[model samples]
Target: MKTLKEQFDILSDGAVDLLPQEDFIRKLERSIATGTPLRAKLGLDPSRPDIHIGHAVVLNKLRQFQDLGHTVVLIIGDFTAMIGDPTGKSKTRPALTLDETRENGKTYVEQAAKILDMSRTEVVYNSQWLDSMSFREVITLSAKYTVAQLLERDDFTKRYRSGEPISVHEFLYPLSQAYDSVAVRSDVELGGTDQKFNLLVGREIMKAYGQEPQCILTMPILEGTDGVEKMSKSLDNYIALTDSAKDMFGKTMSIPDSLIARYYRYACFAGGEDVARMESELAAGTLHPRTAKVQVSGSLVDRYHGEGAGKEALDEFERVFVKKDIPDVIEETVLDGTSLDIVTILTTTSMAQSKSEARRLIQQGGVSIDGTKITDPAALIDLQAPVILRVGKLRFLRISGR
Candidate 1:
């Protein structure tokens, strides 16, 4: 129902800052005229099993193309994960073993499918093509880009100045990623702003192969829970897409109030006048940020899980966290008769990371037993009765008697 440029703008949300707009428009016009949807490709290095909302920002662009009757090819960088992406790393990321890579890739596809329609999407592993390149071919591919250009990338520049060891194989990473575009003959490639350097490399490589360069669309990076750094698993600041609805809602609520609008506009499907109104409402002090965040949380949870689950999650949050009432369907965990420290119980049940962390949490007035704050880390937890264990302001665990 939208024009080519209009659809492009809609997908980009006016955040696209790629150069050479004319070339991008020309390619898009050609695709529109030919009634061929652009071949949009996004590559992911599945070094981690979980995908976050940050990754979904690009995936949402791909979905727009799909809805507009285009082809989206998702490249699972199984081959590249072995070497790891050095895009913004100060030090090299340790390579994942073949087995680990495979396992992560499987989980990546399942989680990514929450945003992308796998039925309409073509999933590819770069290893199929990258592994086939001969030594001569590899050299030929690497010859297109100079080492100086490689060092120009932000991470490489920082690492070079800091005297961090930049491995030779890391240099090949961008080239291998660029080759994916050439292999797929992609009409467009989508990535976060940090990946613009590598995505542009794809454009150059495509041109060298006597093919029209794919148009690059770079999106603004979504900040993690910390609101100051990029969302990443390594930083322990990401909210995994696979998190339960309650967990997702709670994490979303924990984000700084300032980040709510951006998350709504970019991460969620909120757009156009709706987004404008939300922003205005915030500025006018009409809508409370907490309520707005709850809406954002529900929208995101509905996107990954379902509307029913999202509503249920909200209900659970109100019942347990707001009204201070115990959940009806408490999980019953039958434990063996053992003398366990309360902190140990919290850690063992994943309420906290370790006994020390649990103790800190309790000392901060963040831990509760049966709706009462218990600051004693050395407190004994008897398995003779069921008790509700609360951690911080959100998580709850139901512990039952042996």
Candidate 2:
């Protein structure tokens, strides 16, 4: 069993805030002495079923707690999903049906299993308890917090000041989320920085219910591959957990050099000392950003995939991008000997979104056929033999004429 200090050191790494830090240390100490695992709660909004490295920031922290022999309470927000979490939203969020909510939650646990220990972890659906509450019980739960307090939350305040509509149910969203801590008896709740308000509310709600207030730990929001916005699927700036090993490595490499330290720590790398050392080396002009990015990318790929897959991805990346060599898994598409528009072929091969985009790519010197650069979007080429179709970087297709 890990000592309290050892556990704290690991848990605090990359965390943005550990509210009531003293209380967390005390709980950790008690757990170590009594061999009773602290219940670390993390509520998942099933509305977003897919998780990226950004989401992994919190999941990685949970993994640390699991490593320290702590209990993980993965609260699937099926009940709250119907209500929709109003965190960081500018406008009212559209609610999902119970069926939609439940459907999304199914794969959520499976994806989470990639990071959490399923056998030791306890998965619970909020609907199980939230649905059984009487109106009076809910009213009593509501009595715990005030409207003024809820309005003080960042999103509500911004929405109100901007003259946007604030649904009454949106106010209850935090209360419902808070109630999860009460139901699960969470000793510590982990979330991204944006979720601080809700996490703090859970602490207060737990006190109101005559339980020990759960400590809140918020992790930093990971920047996307673009290095500008938060990693999000809506923005297409996310690397999905299910991405191919090569794609994942390639995406990690695409992140700005400035984010190398963050990606190394928050994405998957476990050693805080090592991440710090790497950052120090970069700052001291001892380590190049490109080389550091390769390490970060390799670690991320190796974590999700395997050592072999990680090596393959690293080699493929170096070969395709550095050595100007082709990848191993170029798709072989058999097509009849037919004349095809360059734009049409590019779009058909999923290299670009539309003909206009394909044309733009061609004009930008990003489209090639059989290693030959084709700058003319309107050019039609007759496919007579197998030829490799390349688009920008990281996309390839071998078109064969039959």
TM-score to native of every candidate shown:
0.92, 0.88
True lDDT of residue 317, candidate 2:
92
lDDT for position 165 in model 2: 97
Model 1 score (lDDT)? 0.84
lDDT at residue 310 of model 2 (Cα atoms) = 80
lDDT scores in order = 0.84, 0.88
Count clashes in each candidate, considering only residues at least 3 apart in sequence or on different chains: 0, 0
Worst 10 residues of 1 by lDDT: 11-20
Listed per candidate, the RMSD to the true structure in angstroms reads 2.2, 2.9
lDDT of 2 by residue, 114-179 (tens): 889998899999999998999999999999999999999888999999999999889989999999
Measured with C-alpha atoms, the lDDT of residue 251 in candidate 2 is: 89
Tens digits of per-residue lDDT for model 1, 1-402: 568778768766745665557777786787788887778899999898899999988888788889888899999999989998898778988878867887899998998889888888999999899989999999999999999988889889888998999999999999999999999988888899988998989989999888989888888899998898999887877888888887888788889988998888778867767878888998999999988998888888888888677788889889877897776676656556555778778877877877777888888999887878887888887667777877777667778655
